[model samples]
Target: GQVEGGRKISSNTEASGRFHTDWLNMIYPRLKLARNLLHSDGVILVSCDDGEVANLRAILNDIFGEENFVAQFVWKARQFTDARANTNISTDHEYIVAYARDDGFSLKGVGRDESKFGNPDGDPRGDWMSRSMLGLATRDQRPNLHYDVVDPLTGRVFPPNASTGWRYSKDKMAELISEGKVLFPRNDDGRPREKKFRSEMRSEFIAFRSIIDGVHTADGTQEIRSLFGVDLFAFPKPTALIASLIEQVAADGDIVLDFFAGSGTTGHALLKQNAAENLKRRYVLVQLPEPLDPSNREQKVASDFCDKLGKPRTIAELTKERLRRSAARIDEENPLFKGDFGFRVFKLASSNIRAWEPVAADLESSLLKNAEHLVQGRKEQDVLYELLLKLGLDLCVPIETKSIAGKSVNSIGGGALIVCLADGLSKDVVERLASGIVTWRTALAPAVDTRVVFKDSGFADDVAKTNMAAILSQNGITDVRSL
Candidate 1:
């Protein structure tokens, strides 16, 4: 893959309409997959400039439906200046099109401004803020809630105003007064206010705003400069920008995914947020190995950085390095943070197990030569990861390796899946492996069914293989198979 470098986008018919359609064509399938990955309440935010904002919105609406479309946040990504010199209008803002998987999607609100809250009365309930208890509706609309207030200390009764009504019913108001939640006015005629304790308040969240400002492109550049001591990326996303979006939907220990992880900014932001909040959140980043051209001014810095680190001059390499640097910095900055900042690297490619579709003429020869279905030059670990894919397990799930009966066995997802790629399994080894699996299974206690897999050819004979499966089955491990 090669970087388009903004050359593919233009106002012309060839680039504007056709190019955007092409972009949507590429994104349509990915959007369907992303929807499947999302939780019922999960949200997905896609950032794009003005070029394809309308098209992006249309595609999202078609995929997620109009009802699931949340909001289009206008982010001030840059200062009030035109990106291109010829354009008179300043296209300084970008749009983040958000969509939810279902109606359960709810964004966590920003905490209330604590500065506005205080304990003026020194109430035992701690800090609180006073608010008028008057209802917004007219007295005619809510006749039942239009009752008057009575001040016990003042021994005076105050009637509701002709326009507005009391917020609570007479019985509820009496209960509030009994609980000291209603504030009595010093003057007999003064209006009684309600005491809203910070500890007891339910609606403390400030509503999310559709406009995001303050963070700009310059800030993003400065962030990279601070981290790498040089501008490695010309337009890295601001950590705060992505972190804010993540906080709105993602909770502690949730996984955040970024398929086009340019410079790994999304991963860096997730790590920073986890460190700041003392939470453990994981990230999955995918980037193409789009080579950096030395002739391009924007990519020269990245190219030099690659040369300095003795790594490949590609966007993928830079992305990984950025994550490593960001994690190291976070650990150094916050030594007390115990969250995991490590990420597993996975490359998308064809499976390690060979697929056979031999012709009738060559079928016999193919079977004789390729008795072992496993592909050549593939490592045991490679085969293990391929099994994880075939079994539809998350790649990021923890994988533990142990020596069971002198054979290396991999325990994945906390013993939910036990895979042994060892060769020449004997009766004693089978019994030992089964015992170890049962012990680990009991200790780990995976919520799902535990499964065991072995290389079909690795066994000494059919008897050993059958014996292993039978031993595991006798120990209540029914799900067992071979590669």
Candidate 2:
């Protein structure tokens, strides 16, 4: 369900004079929560266009600390020209704002793509790569790096370029020569350079600037169209771009969450990267279940496209279908690459139980109406999920429900969450709940010091609250929260 005034207040309309302040406040809390959710070494990459990039950066600096700011990646989203537009400048790029959880967080030792390494000359050490030995500094600026490189085969020495200097000092060059890292050209006419063995290089390194080229936006679109025979999404980012970002920020087994899962492209990218690297990276994608608009021609095209591919009509349907196809492709290309594309689905809804009150003549009808309002259109399971999110619990936490004293008492995350979705929480129910805490602690084998959280509205009387608290305190339940 959408929060009505919540949106207006969050977006900060003209009615809210402190629009900028409101916007920052709205995002600040979420970021703070996100920071808590992330691992100590985790990094967050937030994608935004020019519209709010500046504001996002400033707020990120304030929230995550200026020292934790990572590189801002600039991505080219499109290649087509828009000269027909009134504005002379055509915007086709976007930014990915990156920040670390702490100063210790770094991107070093991340795996690099094997395709980037190649060996023209077969070396004993295996695939070797050549890199320029010239530094960007001018010879005049860095005289220490300016030196002559002698071709031992031709007995000739070459002077450093006037514009650029050698990358190493004379002593360092001599050390590299003794170590056999410097490669003299076979022709004896070309400049000498340094050789980097693939085996010697670190598997991971810091990510470069965000400006990505070479991979076309059309490449992603074509990949989807090739599988489905028509554009499944308006614009999808190339797998390479997403893979690069993932490799730089995410660890092998970390869970990546994408709440704005448009067309499920991020899932596909994650799966592809994991398969290629033999890493097990799990992904959770959340998308609004927006229905297809039949009257729109674009919708018609998508519908016909799905028909052509012998698939379902809706976007979510096609998203799963594409994931299956990608998994199949990975399996075909590399038998060793095991692809996992399974996911559990969930939907949000309201609470299941009602706040109890006495059924007196003045309150009877209101109590009945409120009970109906609580459980009429929503399921108990959906309410439980909503509470979990509201309580800042991980979505993947396990939940177990059992009938206790004719009421559904849910033990979530091993009794960290104790919920009762019953019509009226009576004195007997509270007593049972208090006893169940001990049962759950034993069942889950958690430390005797486990916390318990209950719905504030579940208590029927002051005695029930006192008994529950006293029982919990006796059992060493030191932490408790209500919602």
Candidate 3:
């Protein structure tokens, strides 16, 4: 969507107070949160065009300090000429503004060309490259580097140029000559070069270019057409662009998170990249289930597609379906591959625990409704995941269950979160359940202390709840809670 009020030059707003406020107000908080979420070495890239590139740079300069500014990469998104141009002009490029979290951050640059350095002279140190020894300094800046350089073998003096002085001082130049690191020319007026050994180089990679090309938006359209046999998204990013970014920053086992996962291109990119490189990388994509409207020109086909599939008319449903097809395509292509191709969907909703809402007029009915702490018709797995969230466990954490004393118990993240949300908890089974949990906790031996939770209303009586807590506490599992 376009900016609500366009870019306002003035900071002050009109009486109605809507002067280019919608876009800025929406992006400012999200950028702040993204900065807070980034690790010290992590980078945040925001894609924009001529509309808000200046405003984005200004705000980013304020959030991530100017020193942390990485690069403003230009992606050539369009390959073909614009034939339907009203103004006889075409904008075929977009800016990806990147900023690092700290000054220490740097990209994993492109691979180095080792072929450029070879031991042709047989100096015995290693492969070396001849580099110019001229320095970008005037005689006034460094008086020591302006002196004449003598070729010890030729017995000839070579005066350093006033504009481009010698890179090293007189003492360093003499040391290099003694160490045979300075290369001399056979001609009379030729300046010397430095022998830079490959072993002494600090980095193996050279700097990456700021301009990106070859990958185009047309590739993304073709991908959608191949996967779904229809162009569902009007403007989807090509996987090649995202795959390039991933290769520059991410490594094996790294998590690639996309907050606005339109059409789930990032996931598709990471999956194909991992399969091609034989790596273990994962992705987390977050997209809203906003209902698509058939009236909209761009979303009409997508909404109709969802109708044909008997799914909800939402962008998120299409994203899920795309991922499903993407995973199946990978499996079909790579039959021998044995990596994770799992995709799971989760939505934001009310908690499974029923909060007590008391009505002053109907106290008796409130008590009856509040008798059960857990909500009615909630699945056991749903309640267990709720406990996992409350206990600060990963949503994708491993969950294992066991039948303890004829009751269902779940252990999450090994034993970081142990929960028993089962029904029919009585005094007779309290000791047996506690002992089973203790045994499991001992065997798992999680890094952190164990947190056990139970269904508060599942106890037959008050004495049974007390006994359950007491047995667990005696066994050293003190941190316990209930739904």
For model 3, what is the C-alpha lDDT against the true structure? 0.86
Give one digit per residue, the lDDT tens place, for model 3 in 1-483.
322365333333545375456557767887898889777778888888887899899999999999999999999999998889888988899999999989887888988787789998788999999899998799888888899889998788889988979999999999999999999998986889999999998888878789999999999999999999999998689998888888787788888788789999999988888887788888889886767889999889999999999999999999999898998998789877777888767777788877888999999999988887677887988877776677676788788989999999988888888889887898888878888899999999999989898888788888989988898888888998876
Q: How high is the lDDT of residue 321 in model 3?
A: 91
> What RMSD does model 2 have?
7.2
Q: Output the number of the TM-score-best candidate.
A: 1
Better of 1 and 2 by lDDT: 1
* Candidate 1 TM-score over all chains jointly: 0.78
Candidate 1 clashing pairs? none
As for candidate 2, its clashing pairs are 73-210, 109-204, 110-204
Candidate lDDT values, in order: 0.85, 0.73, 0.86
Q: Residue-pair clashes per candidate, as listed?
A: 0, 3, 0
Ranking by lDDT: 3, 1, 2
Candidate 2 lDDT over residue span 1-483, tens digit each: 434553434556757778568767767777777788788888888888786789999989988999999878888877786677688887778888889988877664444566766777766778766777877788678989888887655667878877888888999988887777788877645777888787887555535655876666788899888877777577777777787778666778888777557767778888888887899888877665554555777687777666766755667666667777877777687787764656667755434655666667768677657744445577667777777777788777777878766677787777666776555666787778778766767687754356565556567766777777888788877676655
Tell me the lDDT of candidate 1.
0.85
TM-score of each candidate?
0.78, 0.66, 0.77
Instruction: Order the candidate numbers by TM-score, best to worst.
Output: 1, 3, 2
Residue 65, candidate 2: C-alpha displacement in angstroms: 1.9
Which stretches in model 2 have alpha-carbon errors above 4 Å? Answer: 1-33, 79-92, 108-130, 151-155, 178-180, 186-189, 197-209, 226-229, 289-340, 356-374, 383-483
lDDT of 1 by residue, 149-232 (tens): 878776688888777788888999999999999987777667889898888878769788999998888888898898789988
